[model samples]
Target: MARVSQEHLDARRRQILNGAALCFARNGFHATSMQDVLKEVDLSAGAVYRYFSGKEELIGAIVAEVLETVRDVQECAARESPPPLPDVLIPRVLAQLREVKPGTLGNGEWVFPRLMIQVWTETLRNDELSALMTAGYVKVRAAWANLVESYKVAGLMPEDVDADAMARTMIALAQGFAAQVAVFGAASPEVLRDGLRALMSMGEPRVRP
Candidate 1:
């Protein structure tokens, strides 16, 4: 047998995961099945099985993809000269929320945010998924914590500001936006950018008055 190229393997895995993502978005994870994914991919049982054993593994891959994407976003923001987060990071994030990548299920639909919401519910039942969420949360929190600490050190933010809480607030904002998109359709990038700017202008809360 010819050696499978890494690119080919990656492409095939993405194909399976994207199909599964759409299925989860359409019918929540509890309702989704390996058979549904098989139909979505239009692949032989052997072919699909080679990539993902079942819905469990598929869900894990989906969660991992999200964490990986977030890490990439952090890395991208860090690489910029002054980290133009609003000018750069927000646009990239909006693109993911928009599901700019190819592979449509039907009728030009994109199911990323809804699929993510389903994954959140699945975490309550699956220990593995819950663990993945916890671990990913820590990584995300740490990334934001570092960013927050930098502002604090620069005397931009208060010294007593809780980095962890601030990080969670940011995460909450992003998740809330995703939830809205998941329910309604994707909004224009400018709309999201404007909203984020307004939220930023409010500034991180210091104490409840």
Candidate 2:
């Protein structure tokens, strides 16, 4: 018998996570049974059990992956070559919306809507989950804050501009827009993108030398 390497194990874990996301997206957190997840993954019940002992554990992993993905994408955007604050910020924020799982519009309707609703409810009832979500958002906010501060340094922002507050507001707006898109189902991705662009295009009387 051949022994499985750590790389193989890690690949299988990623596959499982992808499958679980699909399953949870379809059936929702409360309605999605372990059996539903089993159908989604190629692994046997015992194999999945080896990683996540229960449904909550599996969901926790999914949530963590989502947060990590957001952090990673934003970090990459922040490192991009020098650009004005609005220019740099727009791409990162829009890229994030473009990548949101279940998606920001269209086909994401059935999957992401239910999933986010479940996560929101879970956050309300589960203190640990709430802490995790808060911490994750804080990390995301910090990345945005750093980029905003960069803009301030470039004189794009007024000296009175609050980078931290603006960053928090940006994140809050994104979250709100996502939830609205999920609920309204009327706004297209193009519309959402334009709205974001408009927000970034806001200007003050100050000019950089």
RMSD of 2: 4.6
Global lDDT of each model? Answer: 0.75, 0.69
lDDT of 1 by residue, 20-42 (tens): 88888888998888888899889
Reference-based TM-score of each model: 0.84, 0.79
Candidate that scores best on lDDT: 1
Model 2 stretches astray by more than 4 angstroms: 83-110, 186-188, 201-209
- Across residues 61-162, which tens digit of lDDT does each residue of candidate 2 receive? 878877787677667656765533443344455455345443322364544545666788778888878888989988988887877766666666677788
Q: Which stretches of candidate 1 lie over 4 Å from their true place?
A: 86-88, 97-107, 152-159, 202-209
TM-score of 2: 0.79
Model 2 steric clash pairs? none
Angstrom error of the Cα, residue 107, model 2: value is 5.9
